[model samples]
Target: MIDLIALRRRLHRHPELALHLPETRETLLEAISSLGLRVETSTSSSSLAVVVPGAGPGPTVLLRADMDGLPVTEESGVGFSSSNGNMHACGHDLHMAALVGAVHELTRRREEFEGDVLAIFQPGEEGAGGAELMIAEKVLLTTGRKPLASFGVHVLSFAEAGMFYCREGAVMGATINFELKVLGRGGHAARPHTALDPISTAALIVQGIQTFVAQNSSPADPIVITVGSLRAGTAANVIPNTALLKVSLRATSSQTARDAYRKIAGLGAAIAEAYGLRMTSEVGPDLGPTVSDKEGVELVRQTVGDLYGAGRYKELTVPEMISEDFSLFLEETGGAFVLVGAAVDGTPHQLPTNHSSEARFDDSVVPEIANLLAELAIRRLNIASETNRWA
Candidate 1:
């Protein structure tokens, strides 16, 4: 048996960030080195891909785990709290351990299965699009194995511990990052007519966004427009020449997400025109909603039910507002993304969420996640044939 708790604590103590996760990669490599498998390291980024061959011929399956930490300081008060400024606020550390455990268990039972397993340890999942990068690097088809399907696991901080959650379509929302900059004349605070104030225009734009969502979007169609950061003048005595606003948009579908983006752009233009100021803005890359395949999701649902009774697996009634880069991988290779609950000591619905400094992940769920991932791979292999492969 793998020592999952000990390995999780070790990773939790020393968290790394983004694609340059050398320490985290090294730790994972060490944990799985003992297993008799072909392991290869990525030259472009801090990533590892392992291949485990079975006894007979079958389709190949991929299992993924992200290995990046956030910039927040540790405040969960765990015994293995990170002393470094970075922390695993989103439970990536648990993800790493669970993937490793799955590899160990699967390798031991290699003769029992009939296909190959491709386990990928990815980096920079928080916002860096690491999944797409790995896909481009041929992480999915590196061993010349025909791709059958894919599977991934994420630990949630707010749901009930040991419970699994997933849906057949739109499990998570699409996201776009936008920046709006308003330029105007700067002058002394005492002067009124001499200077066009951008701060005032920005405030109006923010308020207008709320009304736009309410008026334009339907109640059944959910859209969220949040202005998370605002920057303006350096001093209180003088008005700044330019104001910067960073906004985030989330929607349930691609068309809805595009409509929300266009709405924000229109609001910025209208606000700037009203104040006789110039506006410049840019929309960053958009992550599409993670839509799961009906067959793949049903397979996962059955596997979870077998692992931990039918009551332990929940089919989400509505999509989540947050976005994940795993959507990129699932889009390229058809699969399902399962969320394993790791609620802390408090009420499941009222606990702190992922990315919160106070959020705590239940370590006991590590093995459960491992079992689910391994079973999903085995079950998918049994259903697929070696001739039917994905490019």
Candidate 2:
């Protein structure tokens, strides 16, 4: 068996970012090569799919783990912190290690089950649309046997470590990236009336944008619009020609997401027009929402409960506002993306959350997720076989 803790630490030390993770790819390739699974690298992106066959023919199941790191510099204070100015603040390193552990456990017990397990190591999930590219390249269909179900696990920073938390529908919200350029006439700062200040216009738009979700959308449906970045004049003396705003929109449903985007864009345009400036707004690709199918959720709930006892599993009453690209898998093949809590030392308040430079993940949850993924695949395989037999 691979030394999971050691492997995770190694990955954590040397983090890679986005779709072009050559080093991460090589590391993952070496880890899975000895297992004798049929592995293929994606021609379009830095991703690979490995097929592990069982003792006999049955439905196929896909287990996925994203392999990408954030661009944030490490302040996590771990001995294994990355020195290259990149950190796995979101715990993708742990995801990779846990999936590898699952591969180790499932391949050893292949004789106990009868199906193929396609383990997908995906990169560029942070914002590069890795899932969409893989889908276009047919990552799901490459296993030869059509996958009856798919399963994926993500680590959350605040939830209790070694526990699983998720909801059945819309567990994660959809993400939309928007850039707004507020253009205005540049003039001397001394002549206040002469300058059409875009910086002032952008400030107003930023403060007013949040009201779109609160006033326009229903309270029952959740939406979040955040202005992550704002930049204007470099010097205090001159009014800049343009101001820029980079914002993110997350919503539980597509309609809510779209509606929020429209309202915000319209508001920005109006603000610019009133200031005698031109505002151009463009929205990026939608990172689809991760929603769990009913059957898949029940299967996971039962499997985790059985393995770690009922207390280890809990479903959230409301979906989380954060977004995930795993939504593509659920949209295509109908599956569940389970959220396993990995708060550092099981105390969320003490440590930073995911995407934080100081964010730290508990390694103890690594094997727990591994066990959950393995058991989920086995149980789903049996359930698929029984359903096929009846049909």
Candidate 3:
């Protein structure tokens, strides 16, 4: 009896961002307040860990939904579009609503399943490492037992509506953020010989990144590097004392990610040292490249095939460049991240991508999404316990 469309539209109208989503958290808490499920909130973040105990105790299963909005202005022009300056332009509003529906479905079928469901509403999924923050608080073991496996689904506004896509391992790319600062003596632009030009040194570092990757990495391996931000020099004629450059790297494997980072950092230092300047580099934690467990993925395939037809489940031959903190969850428990298509209106394979101001999703698939999530949890519990996953 839950009106998922209405709920999603309501959330879509008012979007919040990052770990400190008080309004979004309150809205979610109130929506499920009358459900009588056991709920717990995080001390470090505005995350919710809800448990729906079954008729009998066996094992626990983890299901997650991200709960943050991007910093995009509303332009999708939906009737319930957000006007709060923050937008769920990434389809997280649908994700939250679908998970809520899943909780409701699992509660109604509590007697049919014999294990607990741990529903995680995570914040700061955009880039703030909220998943890592929540996991630090030990919410993963909230059922007093390790979950057999975990599963999460994403709504892709650009993909075909109602279809599910997945891959067995490393379905998404692992990401690393590298920032380099070149320190040198500042001087007028006309006096280039008098000053160690950090700007030129930074440019050399960027060029070296491309050449190093091309020389070292295989073409088939898939490595991506983007210069996110570069800032140097204040005035037109004056050279700044330091030049700062931020680079983002994404790769399919951990070894490749590490190799790329090391080279980039080393390249900056090597170029600076040659220019008689010192370069400082900051390397962030290599966050993702969400790996799907073989068994976990099969569970999704079977569940999706049974719920929908076999044609609904699309296998991914190649991994995606997109990264998610959901990888942090998969690190603790085996899981697969599945993408559900939710295009509002578009031809097949052509639609606006998520994170854009024009992104739109079909909330009518909310029921189907809730059912898939509920089934994954139930099936994981049944199979893991039968195979002695904990023992």
Candidate 4:
């Protein structure tokens, strides 16, 4: 068996970002070189898929793990921390290692199942839409047939160790990236009345949007809007011609996200018009929220309860504000995204969350993750064979 801890730490030491993860891919390839399973590579991104054949002919089931790191610098104080200025603050190291471990587990019991186990290692999940790229590159058809169902596991840095959390529908929120620009006249700072300052217009637009969103937001229908970047002028003495504010909107559904974006555009235009300046907003790729099928979530719940006892299973009542491209997999082939808790030893409230510079994950949960995923694949394949479930 591969030393999962050493492999994960090595991956952590050489963290790579976005789609072209050459170093990360090489390490992962070395980890699986001795497994002797059928492998396939992607041309669009640094994504790969491995297939383990079962006893009888049956549909394929996919197990996925994201393979990208974040842009944040590490501050977790671990001995094996990354020094390449990029860190796996989101626990992609753990995800990759656990998936590798699960692949090993399934390989040992290949004859006990009825279908092929397709393990997908995907890169560029942070913001590059690696899932979409893989789908476009025909990575989903690696097993000679489109996957009947796909399953993925995500490790949370702040969640309790050894617990599995999931929800039925809309488990993750949608993303809308917008840039609100106000066109104004540039003039000398000394003459305030002659220049239509966009900085003032931008300030007004930000305040107006925040005020409106706050008044409209509620517990049941929450909308989150954050102005991540704002740029206006190069020098203090001269007023710039334009002011741009890069904003991100998060909501439970696509309709809500589009509605909020429209409202924000309207607010920006209104504020700019009031200031006698033109305003325009452009929206980026709107990746819809992730929704898990009812049957898939139920199967995961049963598998977790039976394997790790019922106490290890926790049902999430609400959707998270974050978003991922994994929504594409669930949409292509119905499946559930399960969360495995691997927080370091600390109070839940005190531990740092994912994407934080101080975030630390417990590598001890790698074996547990492996066991649960292996059991899920076997049982799901058996159920599909018996019932001929083509979903």
| TM-score of each model, paired residue for residue | 0.94, 0.96, 0.91, 0.94
Q: Provide the lowest-lDDT 10-residue window in model 2.
A: 382-391
Who wins the TM-score comparison? 2
Q: Give the runs in model 1 whose Cα sits over 4 Å from its true position.
A: 385-391
lDDT of 4 by residue, 253-307 (tens): 8999999899889989988998899999998768788888988899999999998
Worst 10 residues of 1 by lDDT: 382-391
lDDT of each: 0.86, 0.87, 0.87, 0.88
For model 1, residues 238-321, the per-residue Cα lDDT tens digits are 988999999888999878988888878888888899889988889876889988889889998898888789999999998888
> Which model is ahead, 1 or 3, in terms of TM-score?
1
Cα lDDT of model 3 by residue, 45-100, tens digit: 88999999988978898999999998899898888889889999988889899999
Each model's total of backbone clashes: 0, 0, 0, 0
Which run of 10 residues does model 3 get worst, by summed lDDT? 382-391
Go through the candidates in order and give the C-alpha RMSD of each one to the true structure: 2.0, 1.6, 2.4, 1.9
Error of 2 at 97 (Å): 0.5
The best candidate by lDDT is: 4
